[model samples]
Target chain A: MLTAQSTKQFKFINIDRVALIAAAAGLLSTFAAGFVTFKPNRIAAGEAFSLAASVPLQGFLAFLALWILVALLSISGIRLEKQAVFTSICGGSLLLLTFFLAGQYATAATLEHGSISRISPGTGMWIMVFAEVVLLLNAVQRGGERTRFVTALSAATVAGFVFLLLTGHLNDISIMKEYFNRQDRFFSEFKVHLLLATSSVGAATLLGIPLGILALKKKSLDAPTFFTLNILQTIPSLALFGILIPLLAYLSARYSLIREIGVQGIGWAPAVTALTLYSILPIARNTYAGFATVDPGALDAGLGMGMTRTQLLMKVEIPIASPVILNGIRIALVQAIGLTAVAALIGAGGFGVFIFQGLGQAAVDLILLGAIPTILLAVAADGITNWCIAVIQPRGIR
Target chain B: MIELVNVTKEYPGTVAVKDLTFEVGDGEFCVLIGPSGCGKSTTLRMINRLIEATSGTLLIDGTDIRDYRPEELRRKIGYAIQSVGLFPHMTVAQNISVVPGLLKWETSRIDKRVGELLDLFGLDPSAYKGKYPRELSGGEAQRVGVARALAADPSILLMDEPFGALDPITRESLQNEFSRIQRGLKKTIVFVTHDIDEAIRLAARILIMREGELVQYDTPENILTSPGDKFVLEFIGTDRALKRLARLPVQGLMRSALSVVLSDDPGKVEKSLAENSYLWVTDNEGRLKGWLDRKVLDKAPFNMEDSIVRIRVADFAVSPDSTAKEALSKMVLAGTSSAPVVDNTDLLVGEIRLADLLEA
Candidate 1:
């Protein structure tokens, strides 16, 4: 069934079949499942409700408009060669619509049952979220201005959603209720989470970068350093945290100065220490790989041009290796963000408090309150660092 | 001036260069040429102390090279390589000014030097100064590499197959430009290449090396006329006569042309044409306008204002800057024994005869 013209046209169209299939599947499942769940109170299990039963007429119409827009955009993409910008715009619009409808549905449910009823988004809404993400990823693969477009779209979505929250349009939702109940605690936990992630990545960078450079310069150290880091990487996050606790306890007990400085068996000290150890592997590995792959010709030229060893490293090798090194830092940053949530188990005091508490109470909404922001934080970190890497890459190489 | 006496470089398993001796006079363009693994590159590197001589004395300006710090010695010896090895991140001006900047030269001095070097390499300073290496054509980047090497105004230059990566046409043009630049500056240069043709074209003295040893060192003409051994003869190839022609320029052999102005009396023009088969006709500025054939003039009415036998110079003309071989080919293509040579202004300079080219 293949022909030269068909293949040529396919290349020109640049259609992503995976995204198309996912969107179609998501649309089909939306009709088959409940769009939202209604509960009598924050403590009660919710009952599933279809979109027609929950959302207002305007909300439904907006959803329909979004669907039509997505289809039109995709069809136009098939007819044109440059479609990344259009696809990303469509994906961003869909994301905004999904959030708008959820807020509207919550508002509508609250109007009907007042403060007694609690509203939560259902499987249909989650499916749409997954579909939009896949579509955005497809646009990203096409490159060009797509990343910038998507980033702008995400910023707008976050701003609009925050505006709705500030205006108390969705105050009736169970997660919002959970948030209102512990507003001060929630902010403190977010701060702790951010601090834990950043400080650990900072420490990892300080230790790993030098080790990476040394490993590159001294060939004898490369194998042993990588082997140890690889073993550390293979350890489970929780197990690593557990292993750190006793070692820190012994150290704190052995030294009166350590105890005076608040180094203990548990808390931020052990949590940050474990996180830093976990972060070192990615930073070290990427730094080594970056330096190892520098064009040998450039090094030879630098040396032949009378550059001293330090001068060559500073001017030629480091600048060439920086983008790759930053890429490694990006991986470490995102990983550290996710791991900090687990660090809450050691009383490190982050959003993980909500997750564990929700588990004890069997409250899915509380768990989502902790989980959603964590995902968004990781995504934002990834986007920002990827932009940095792209910007710092040498113009000639690019 | 550079002198290497019994210099040797040994690696873990094999000797790279062994017991080499040579002296390059000041302002000489000395080229080291050989097959791969023949130690030509090693010899050049040793001179700059990039690769230290294991057991010998290498002298520059009559001072032993070992007494100077490698970095200090290298800073005084400009180096360029085959890949050009231009810093990808730096602009053309920045790349050219690297050494000057390192030596803490004033900003104005570096800027003026960059402009001068760009102009010297035939690259327009305003157009190419801000461009990155990636934005340049291969030839332009190679020129920038050479410009960067020459930035410090070092008396000695070391080039390693600097034009090896360019296309043949680009390589030929670069060679011509380099020869022009070398004539003006007269820097002491040590060039290394695997190409004998390049060595012959640019080097005042050619040092041909075999595996770890110097096989011959002499002037290009001497090498062509009397190769040191069978290896040297075979390596120069069988086209020695053609190559020797390539070495001679048309300007060196061109003779004054017999030309008559259009304003000259037709009787006098005809008389001049009788001596030669064809006489070149020129305008008031000595530009070649056409030619007068004796046979055609014989049948004409011979009126000054009306009739004359004439053919446009475009039909049979060469440039004064062309090689003698190029002039000979042009003459053969035009089916003429001689052709007029013009300068860039289109003014007739002289004539080139097929016999003169053959004799050269």
Candidate 2:
């Protein structure tokens, strides 16, 4: 590759490879557990089965492909060892393959419901524990070397545990069963319905960033856009959903397109809509700030160096302002997560399910179940995303 | 080669550069110098199309600057500024390779060029390639800026206070190094500086500007000897005499008529100086030894070389065309009553006293 020299300069020290392998293993195993426990048959029937019997097979296959590519390049003497690109492609593909396999395995497992006794800590469980151990070791050793690594690992570990609990293991075990049986236990069931809410936050990011850019270019649009988001946020979430029900139902019947795009009933539709509306402000504000923060002299330098407008924006301006954009995303993400709990009013089951269920029965255990994970998830998401931002930070930037 | 034709830049309240006209011949080292806000920077920036000219034309090798796009024009002209402006994120090698990379040169060639530049600037290519700007000292970074600007081997180089951020010792050393490098490459250069000393040291021809107007555009010697007006004279300042003497070779000032003094004949110096009030002494090979006073004849037979008041010949002289003001300063600095002025060959000509120099 043309980046061979650059690759050499950025080569992972030999000790880091073990950490990388461990991290990859942990991610693979966590994905497998989610697939297995979330399967309908496994949840309903409660059977003991190895979740990811096929992972070893898939991992071996991936390793083989990577090995072959490296060997071929080395034999040909092309000097094309782009480690970062190579690792990303190989790791990403393996993770994706694992996801596909888990999905298929879960569908099969969920097909036939069994008793709760059928679910035991078996080979799959042991494999997952072992994977976690390796990942933990990697995180402890390599993550200690860098602030970003430590932050990413700590976040991933917390998020991984939450994911594991939501899937089945934490609630299924005898030690934690007392907490689960409480009538008002918020997170009694391992249903992570937060994805629906999180998706809206992502959607908001996609829409808000562009809108903010446009607003920056055209100052006239700023006030109106700001007012609209402000009004959306001002309305109580429950009231907002109550208002959306009639309007959405009418719109849904009138236009099949609205229904097709996943905005159906007042449940997820209103919840997602409310969360998305709440998310726009921070992202928009941050986008404007990011664009405005572009160094004028740097832009001039880019132009002075013969960079086109597009090149200058993409390579110079954006990189320089990326920290601000990342901060905007962070603010939006945290806000959306909190507001998503409010979606429980319209049957949009998030951690808010625990809040509402606990309130109805006056069960503190139930409230703790739902409330704890919700806060943890938001905190974990914030920490991880922030770590990712720090990792990719522009080098020379002040 | 570059020419500024009746160029004038006017702001709301003032003209930044007015009616400036000059041609920098190919391979010439021309410096633009003045105090701050003298429009030297404005003039240099206009060359790269950084600032649009309010009126008149800037021609680079004959083609008007407006004929090309700003980026294209800048790429063809190498530029270095006081701040260095190196991308902090980029490694030393990457920073140096920017223009070449922009031009889409092959990676291997770019690597080779970057290495060559680092070596040329006295930095080890291996040690510095991946290191970012933050790791470099000020002098190293400034040199890197120069290397980066020259990456494309542009025919014309423009610099605005490139070494202004550095300590005096580093700045002067870099100036000398750059001067040495320029002598070989001979790229047409337009250097901007606020220091008149730096201007005289680096420039073959100096353009003195003040209040957005060209004060004088002449050789350092001519500028010092004959200022265009009071402004030019004051701008060059009272130190012009000392500064002008600095430019002259010491060979030009030493006295050629001197009594030869042998190491063995220690007493011969008093006998040789008996007739003349003070005898100019030299070694066996006829190089200057020192000055011997006639009263030394009464003293113990001291070797002429031992008692002689030896002055560094290199430090004692002024160029013949040097202004009387310059010669006087040299005499004062050297603590000599008179100057033993010589031609370029170190052959002593005649003496010029402090009184005569003052009278002139």
Interface RMSD of each: 1.3, 2.4
Model 1: lDDT equals 0.84
lDDT of 2 by residue, B29-67 (tens): 999998899999999988888889999999987898899
Cα deviation of A238, candidate 2, in Å: 7.6
Model 2: residue A213 alpha-carbon error in angstroms: 6.6
Model 1 alpha-carbon drift over 4 Å, by segment: A1-33, A66-117, A128-154, A181-185, A214-278, A343-349, B258-318, B328-340, B345-348, B354-359
The prediction achieving the highest DockQ against the true structure is: 1
Candidate 2, A1-398: lDDT as tens digits = 65878877884433335434544454454444432333132123333433344335665455445434433322343212233223333333433343444434433433444322212233343454454444333434433335354445444555555565566534543223424455344343324355765687788889888888888889999899888877877888678778888888888888989988867667778777777877888888788888886645445555666667787777666776678788888888887777777777687777777778767766444555566667767876798788878887877665
Task: Please list all clashing residue pairs in model 1, or write none if there are none.
Answer: none
Could you give the CAPRI-style class of model 2? Answer: acceptable
Where is the poorest 10-residue window by lDDT in model 2 chain A?
A: A34-43
Candidate 1 TM-score, C-alpha based: 0.83
Candidate 1 lDDT, B82-169, residue by residue in tens? 9888888778998898888778899999999999999999999999998998899999999999999999999999999999999999
- lDDT against the true structure, each candidate: 0.84, 0.69
Clashes of 1: 0
